[model samples]
Target chain A: MKMVRVIVSFLAMFFVNAVSAGVDDTVWKNELKTQFFADRSISETENIIAIEAPYRAEDAALVPIRITSKINQTNDKYIKKITLIVDKNPTPFAAEFNFTPLSGKADVAMRLRINSYSYVRAIAEMNDGQLIMAKKFVKASGGCSAPIGADLDAAMKRLGRMKFKLSGTAQSNEPNLAQLLISHPNITGMQMDQVTRFIRPAYYVEEVKVTFDGQPVLTAKTDIAISADPNFRFYFVPQSSGDLRAEVSDTDGNTFSQTYRVEP
Target chain B: MKCIWIVSLGLCLGLFAVQCQAKTKETLEVQKIAPGLYFHFGHHELPNRDNHGAIANIGFVVGKECVAVLDSGGNPQQGLLLKNTIEKITDVPICYVINSHVHPDHIFGNRSFKGRGVQFIGHKNLARAMQARGGFYLQRSEEQLGVKLAPKDIVLPDIEVTDSLTLDLGHRLLTVTAHGSAHTDNDLSVLDKNSQTLWLSDLLFVEHLPVIDGSLKGWLRELKALSALKVRRVVPGHGPVMGDWPAALKPQEDYLTMLLKEVRSMIRQGKFIEQAIAEVGQMATGRWALFDAFHKKNITLVFAELEWED
Candidate 1:
């Protein structure tokens, strides 16, 4: 009965196309604005970051969002965290990612669900406690409930298969692009398992840490907005051949870790 | 067949798996739809042990100085056959290799056209869709369908049509329009202006039941918009070629609309997907091929979306 109430309320969000249901868009923005910034002063500058998604989402359930930091500063004033928000989703908060000096440029790309044609905003939290935002309007609806492509059993069985691929030949001591894939449903509580006729409990990758030679490169704190079988693409300057490690922990407290050797 | 419903799940599941070898190449037969426009008709056989995942319609359009391939065959071997067939005809340089969407049966043969100096064209989302599912499809082609994919097998679109773009095949011209997610997120339809033929490429299913990979609402909207286009003929991706445009678009529209209304009603009644799967759209089962295998999936997908609708 409570689930019905939640779904109906979510549907109302769809019907009203209310920039902010029960609150104005600016109000919702300010609310999130407060959470990410806290007491820190906010300077809305276009200098540091750009958020990119297709003007029209090809697949609502798997809309790819790419965030790039124009500034390559390593520490101190460097970007400390990145957060994503879909103003119209049933659950508006998407994700927040953290970066370290080893992460050559604070550039990362991941996919998420866009429940409706809404403004998808990405905010970067600087170490100095300043927050800046970039926004893109994504035209998509009904992403959260899109049917899972894989069988429920198979999807559950292969919950943590990991694969890594180099974008190009890793030149000695050059910034190399790497792709990491984790097999996961990234289920939001709203989804119903067709097989069992029951709602699938929310289970998603909560944190992901990428390290090169045991030194932290990047740490991503994600949420249900992340797509199933999430993929992370980033850059790292490898000094020499070393083992690249990925440690992912989901909301279910399930930790999956794998190490892929960087080919010389 | 025993019933009209074809078991298309064979191709999706690769029902009979085998290790494919380079089979003896066969010559492709192309039917002349209009002057200089030809299409290769495929069998209704499921993509199984015998067919080698080659059950979709494919063809090429010839212009004055060049030619444009509409959709390639399913596997590398079938692509070779289609290529050999083109060679047997007039020798016009292939200016464009247009993929209808990211379906394996429609794209795997792209390997045969590698290095032919042909530009592969598709919807803007084709590359991403291929990136998301290419590896799985490549693996399944071998594991389930017995077709081994080569390095150049899966072709990503070089020319992405975000809105609408036209290709000049010599004196003749063909318009390619990118429609929002219909059968798939990357469904691209071609319109040959010289001849009044609209290549609906999975947009309009003639006899075969439609598969819903993208949005059901979007697909229905597409059909409504396509019904207004005054084309003399239609070339469907999986069914019989049609001689009429709007008239031929009825059954599919009715089918989709029926599912839409029924699914919405079921959701209002608080029916779960399992109950709606059996109860919704039972009246039209005999009118379509692969109704049993894909119909429920369509219902499942559509219900999942409409259930969230207010």
Candidate 2:
């Protein structure tokens, strides 16, 4: 009887692992790594950076993701760039964030379109070229292929409109949180027109630049994976009041810029 | 004598098999809400494998010439069953299958009604919406709803209602009006002028919670305009038919308005979407069924839209 019970428990454990293994197929190691970072080693560790995402995304089109860094930005040594990738999406390269020393912290929060149940990974590259990564498995599907916007007409009417909101009073030499909201549909081009039999062309924001007093804080190269009305929350160090400005450019060659005056 | 016994036994077995088949085939149940208006009240439950995605109100209106089907059932099987039920009630050939919106529960059954002379109708934006979501809906049908579907299952509307199109169902005239972005970007409501019955599919949620796939502000705007219409009874997509015209619109209006007010305030307070989802819309939890399933998602969508408000 004891032997039978032990064998039954072992079989149950094996089944559970097999089911979970199918979910986290680890396509990143074979495909994503070779395609993105060839010959360069990326350390898969949580010490340098940690990714926060809903285990089961509430909205596939707008899954909120936050990447926090363990080390603060310093002139001597700081993280230079962070790349976010969703493994199972048609285009897995979601966004690449280039951070400067003026960016007091490397933390970033944004919404993304996750196409399937896949791993969302954020890899941080230090100024010295060392890469460290963190990832979370998100259960979501059909975000890229879902209709562009619930209110596509409304989104089109206010295309390229941008806004900046500062969370609280800025302290000099310390990281202050700011949110940048841009109005764009970020169409994935995967949607098909049943009648016309024509595929909608992909139109999305390609570049975003944020500056604090003319000093670059965060610059991001985004793709269709970025959710509609792309909203980003990041930190910048304001040395005694400055003009915070954001310039956004999309695939259609439309450029929009907005500036908010900040006081420390 | 042996040959006679064998023939008698075979006849008896055949009769039993026919009886069993008849007993197992479930027929759709519908009620006559008005003079010529028939309504099938769907149970308030989430669409699952057990229910086969037939969790929405669907019915037909009979007139002198033909019959107009309001939103079809959730799956192709339900659509077939609805067709059978309509045939049992009246010999009027189904002239029009009017789709209320692009949601699967309302439009998935469109395939079963595809035939020559039977025109499928929807809002002007319905074609675009259907095209955009058709692939995704087909991919998820088997896994999510436990129903396997092919590309032929997604039927596009032959006639589009940009503003309002009136169909002569023989003696009765049904006016199909296309509204702005409310429940969805492509939402159509049919009004039977004879019986004064408005088939506002998914526009008014009676017991079930109202889902916001479109703009929150837009839905509230639509309710204001639709309330002024003179109607004796209304049929919702999820709940029972109501005799009160505008009075029946109160519960949904209140819930939506409250969500707008609360989420807007939270945005003004410099709160995040995460915080708003957790804190907003707590007062009306037990008032509506399926609040747990859709309330948080509603909050998330509302927060994203209202946060952009100036």
Candidate 3:
């Protein structure tokens, strides 16, 4: 009996070593659980939500990530809140977005600064108060420190200009997808001034509220982790032909708004 | 007829000389730019397998005790080649390897000098920057450029120069000055006291158009300070060795200044980035090489930066 037990233990040791030699299967998803879900019971389910990011980030600074709710829009199990987390960012919690029933659907896309190999999780809070999450393993590093796409004065001068495109032509009472481009510096306080040799103060857009014909769509509360000139894609139901407005406000208490006409 | 014949002969000789220089450039080696200073000029273009990542100006200052190498080439092979060239020049031990910035073309050659007991020097933020980018750069070297890189090829500096630090090569003390984000966030320039020659790595461009990867406002501000240097000659990162330096900076300055001034006006007029991308910098079209490929990125960067000013 002792000899049989010794053989089994040796075999188990060999198995552990062999498995460890390969990519150490503590997958990015598992890492996220430890990083964000200590002591909290978090539920992971498929098809409730799906998160999409590049398999490998080409430009670590500007990684595009999109999260879509798979639950039927007509169902009462709707997404009320979402928390964006990049596991390895210096500040791992990227942003949190809140929505109301007036929101057409919780399909949001934005750019993030992924500083390293991290599992980006989108935890959607349903109306029943259950949190469901979808994750993607993003193979990118060094997004937080990646230089903003431009110079100080130059990036600041073009601030507050917004452009948007509708994914599909508007139909009355149908939720349509919209992609918005907001030209804000989104400066994280970590960046240093190029000439002054001092840390540049943090200035970024804190809130973006989208409405179609004065009806609520989605209000996103963002942080510095959003890349410069923030981009967003969300769903909105157009009850009729009217103006879709994006009212953006920054940390400096500056508000910039732009309106786009959508035809039914 | 006699004058015409003389002119034709002179033109033939000039063309032949040009052809000869081009041929020699294929296996080119470093040349003496000043007393005790040697440099090799890289081609004016992007890095590729053919150039073998030698698209930046690399050189060394031979102090009496040892040699200080500035800006190793783009790959390990180029670094090895640079080492070989140094061996051929003199038998002195190499003391310091200075990286101009984090750009792959400049620091990839760092591994070739390993085991030589040399201290690698760079901007204070280099380790952080390299840590973030080293993996991707290593991967790209293999996939895109088709050049396989070992882990060691991505070298980080041990000696960080935050404000300014001077090192001795025995008799020569080279002052490595760290500048704020211009050209790149981790840019540093070296000054040789013995020769009074300022080596402005990528900070100044001569014939080729300056590429903007950092803050344009910051770059323009740095240019203003760099213009006051009273050096005898200047070594640019990707252009011919220049004599009239601060003056040589005018064309690049003009282009960047115009980009800022006009782009700001465009924004103030409520013209979007799409319009600025199409119309800005059209006047400087014929004056620069690879303008079409790199100009839009510059405009985009500048426009994005300018938008936040308000």
Candidate 4:
């Protein structure tokens, strides 16, 4: 009986180690919870939102992540905001996205720079002020490629260029997918200049506001973790023929705006 | 009789140790592709702990007055092996070490040739790329390549080639040309005037799947410029050297062109990147080695670039 007990304990320990192989989840768990929602309880379940990410990213510089809401965006009960977090990144807080009733759906997709293998979490704050969370483990890519933008020159040459891609035509009072493309080299300040031997300062998009017919749809505050040439896909509902406008600003105080007509 | 037998055994052991040392110091194997031009072909495999990143074609050109090392090696030790090979072949001193591009596999061996009177040459943008990527490369070399690299391993070029530069190695003259963004932002190709041999490093891959770390459109455009060149034979960064001038470039061109076309059409269909990555390259498999390793990343990069097209 003693020998069997020892074997069982050994197997239990091995399983525990295997489960917690990557960076400690508790670091981000405690730190982010304390920082983002101090004195407030957070529900650690996929009841409100769920995040989708590759189990192993092929490119560390551009890992695609999407967040889907289980409930619809209604005035009475809706997801008001969602905060994305990477546990092992230099900055655990990646971005915070805010939505209004004008947003037909709370689904969003974007690319991020993951520095190391860690848990990616999305915390949703509902209209009732309840905070719900979803998390996924991701293994960061390892190779010759660095977690930085490729073709910085091309991104710089077309800086502040913006375009709107709408899926099919807009429908009245229903969810329609729209993508916004912005050209900006989100320099993370980690790279050193060979000749100058100096670290470049971090310059990235600080704010993004999207509106339809002057009604607010989505607003996001992001940091350097956002990939260069930021591309965002979201859903917005148009009542009739109107205009969709996107206004973006960076840390350097540069603001760019573009407007596209939506014919229902 | 017993004492003599013991003595002979010790002698035999000493000889074995000496033989081991000599074997370790054996020079890297190289083939003389042309008169005064030597080439070393690297195997098509991903950089791993077993290889230590020594997976790029590296060689040298011997001239009357001096020798020019085209690329060093994948690591400091590989660089040392290459230096030993050069010493065994000729007595001329090495004058210039020309780097092809910024990939770690191509430039990591630079530390082996760091000495006075041996000037390093590269594209004008090479230093900037090295500076931007050197720290990250140094940090991850240990975990990825199983070799810990210091800041010294990331050497910058002393001389930059903006448009074109010519170096005289006595009877041999090498014309170094800097290309626009193709394989990478900084790509330099060397042409030997006397032999008409062009060393088109990663810019042309004969067998290995060509990696696209730069613009897909830019690479297609650079292919046009490279195909128009007139040369007796060309050296690729990977695979065998070919005497067929522009004809040797067809495989890489076709691969890049197919990728561009599929990605553009996917964008036209309003497909997302994930959908395109899954459905785009089904037909092009088994054509190139390391396709599974690098194709998805290539599709992702090309999709990101072409989606913004007007």
Which candidate achieves the best DockQ against the true structure? 2
Q: Candidate 4 chain A: minimum summed lDDT over ten consecutive residues — where?
A: A14-23
User: Interface RMSD in Å per candidate, to 1 decimal?
Assistant: 17.8, 5.6, 10.9, 5.3
Docking class of 4: acceptable
lDDT of 1 by residue, B69-161 (tens): 888888887787888887777698777889998877788888788775788998987875565456445544543355567545767788999
Residues B125-231 of candidate 3 have per-residue lDDT tens digits of 67655654465566546433446776667677879999999998888889999988777767899999889888889887777777777778888998899889898
Candidate 4's residue-wise lDDT over B1-310, tens digit each? Answer: 9999999999999999999887879889899998999998899988876688999999999999999998898888998999999998999999999999988888888998999889999999888788777888887786567677888898889999999999999988999999888888899999998889999999999889888887889988988988898999999998899999899998988999999999999899888887877788767788998887778778888888897788
At residue B284, give the lDDT of candidate 3: 91
DockQ-based CAPRI category assigned to the predicted complex of candidate 2:
acceptable
Q: Point out the higher-scoring one by TM-score: 2 or 3.
A: 2
Question: Which portions of model 3 show Cα errors greater than 4 Å?
Answer: A1-215, A219-264, B1-28
Report the number of the highest-TM-score candidate.
4
* Model 4, residue A207: C-alpha shift (Å): 1.1
Error of 2 at A19 (Å): 7.8
Clashing pairs in 1: B6-B290
TM-score of model 3 (CA atoms): 0.61
Individual DockQ of the candidates? Answer: 0.02, 0.36, 0.07, 0.35
Which residue pairs in model 4 clash with each other? none
Any idea what lDDT model 3 has?
A: 0.75
Alpha-carbon TM-score of each model against the true structure? 0.54, 0.92, 0.61, 0.92
Q: Report the lDDT tens digits of candidate 3 across residue range A1-264.
A: 769966865665566445323333254347655665565565788867889886655345667688888864544667888989876565667778776665677888887876556677898878777788888877652211243443343446677888776755677776687777898878766532221224446788899998877876788888877887898878877777889999999999999999999997
Model 3 CA lDDT for position A182? 91
